[model samples]
Target: MSLDYLQLAGTKAKGKRPQFFADSDNERLLSILMAVAGELAVTRERLDTLERLLEAKGLLSQDEIETFTPDSDQAEARGLLQQEYIARILRVVQQEKEALEEQQHCQSNNDLSEIEQELSRI
Candidate 1:
């Protein structure tokens, strides 16, 4: 199913390139949120779906499921850390987009490229 966030005027985000969508700051934050959330939600859903399917198909036993806890303490801690990281990023991108919109520039590349850049740097 299409996501609710898909209806938002956000998908215009591309890059700092000369393309029109590339230069839009309007709803860039929204676009980013939608893209990332959609991916994460799909992943979570797929994992859960697969878990159920495996159980039904006898490909995985109950003990296997019990051992494979994505929500375990360590996994949960990491998830929380990642969530905070993304939330902080989106917050910054969102505020920047709003500021740019107020100035009518509405085209600042979301300037949200730092996080991914840093990740790639690592």
Candidate 2:
């Protein structure tokens, strides 16, 4: 079975993100760190599986695996994967930033209304 890494990476989770820490920034950082840890764990498992399969078939060796290099197209695809991975990890931060911007925008509009009200009384 083939996995669509890019499509899966781009998918956003629905519903509000729960916070375990008092500070939202701490929560965001925790999310990012956990994502990194989870990615590392999955990658390690996949590498182990590949190594075992190759050894079983006598198709690859440790030295060859270490020295293997990708062609240009493969390199570009790997780069895209890396970008998607990073984006997934940073999603929390991006959400927080958007929320804060929206809050500030609303506050500015409210402030403008207050100023206009005061000006009308003059």
Candidate 3:
């Protein structure tokens, strides 16, 4: 798991650094995406190495690797993890969605209370 290959390509600037992103939000999102991409690249390299080793040992073939499918439970778990990965990438969106849902819930509760009061008056 040597990350020497993942080093950012550039020499450090001698003076004050210019902004890579237009704003703080873009900068944060870019950082998150870069980190995720770097990790995924490392994992992909390791998986490729493993596949080559297995093929060399006569235990697996390139065709088998391409066609590989998990069994039922494994497939389900993989699906769940895939969903989680998407959520992680869109975590800000997920948080905003949850906040909106909570706001709607409170509005709905208030509406319900108003309806009940009108009914009581009637």
Candidate 4:
């Protein structure tokens, strides 16, 4: 069977996520920033490759690439791609937020149990 990269990327590992910093939010932010950086690096490399290939094939020049502007449809398509790219980068923050909310819910339940027990003693 062919590998499904999108599925693999979305899958969560079985074990607890490792924390590298004291604050979990900091770690999540760092993950998001790193994802952005990685995406930018890959995009830059791919763009450069495409530019080189086009120039070599006598189809386009570096000056033309620099000055080219997308029309309405192309711009709309790129806007959609940008939205998806941003969502991918922010996935870490979203996951962490959900995990934090779950933790707070569990803590609230435990606190409620303790309060009930204390009320019973009074």
Candidate 5:
């Protein structure tokens, strides 16, 4: 989602940049957003690869295969730990998704003056 906004900004920059946009512009903002988007994309891809490898190796799996079988107490603890780690990851993903959604909503509907005022309060 952040990438989407960044790509939009980049495309805008590549075309005819308006005069007002250049006025009092935060010169570093667009590049920062783009860098952030790129890093995030890389991170997401790495995470996906890690998940696939973990699945294949029966470390953190989705199906009841050669994975997390409760034979010993240590096995049960390991399974629980993996489950907790996955759950934490899911929660973080959810939070990021929600933050992206909120940012979109704010961008689309909220006025700049309103945002500025809110920021001032902060």
Candidate 6:
């Protein structure tokens, strides 16, 4: 098994991506979503580089970049990234939540700050 992060979604022998979400509600939509996500990621990186170049050339200011907000489509893309992120990390998040609940029950009725202090001592 190769542990390549970029190929986690898998690909064919000819460098084509395999449809991992074929059984999804709308396979076409899923494929498009994945394509859009990939494109948006690349576009975002390129935009960041462009902004840095502009700033370096004194054409754009740091404040302008810092205060920038995405338009509706970019905002939606961010939402998609957030959803995909939750899907990716849900299991670990659940496990951590369960562990925290267990620790809360096992420990006294102290607040989280007290628990942190106790943990730091350990």
Top lDDT model: 2
Residue by residue across 17-118, what tens digits does model 5's lDDT show?
333246323533453455557666887999789778988888776654445456788787667655543433343244446668999888867687688889
Q: Give all TM-scores, in the order shown.
A: 0.32, 0.74, 0.50, 0.70, 0.32, 0.34
Q: Candidate 5 has which clashing residue pairs, if any?
A: none
Highest TM-score scorer: 2
Per-residue lDDT of candidate 4, residues 1-53 (tens digit): 11243334445558887789998779988888888999999999999899999
* lDDT tens per residue, model 3, 14-119: 5653459888578657755864797599879999899989999999999998998899999887776665555545544445466689999999999999999999
Ranking by lDDT: 2, 4, 3, 6, 1, 5
* TM-score between model 3 and native: 0.50
**Which residues of candidate 2, in runs, are more than 4 Å off?**
1-12, 105-122
> Residue 5 CA error for candidate 1 (Å)?
25
* Backbone collisions counted per model: 0, 0, 0, 0, 0, 0
Assess the local accuracy of residue 99 in candidate 2 as a C-alpha lDDT between 0 and 100.
77
Residue pair clashes in candidate 6: none
Model 5 has how many clashing residue pairs?
0
Cα lDDT of model 6 by residue, 37-109, tens digit? 7667987999889988998999989898889899999998777765654443333334445668989876765
Q: Rank the candidates by TM-score, best first.
A: 2, 4, 3, 6, 1, 5
lDDT of 1: 0.60
Lowest lDDT sum, 10 consecutive residues, model 4, at: 1-10
lDDT scores for all predictions?
0.60, 0.84, 0.68, 0.81, 0.56, 0.62
lDDT winner, 4 or 6? 4
Instruction: Give lDDT tens digits, candidate 2, residues 1-122.
Output: 11465456546689877789998678878999999999899999999999999988999998899999999999987888788888778877766677789999999999999999999999
Alpha-carbon runs more than 4 Å astray in model 6: 1-26, 66-122
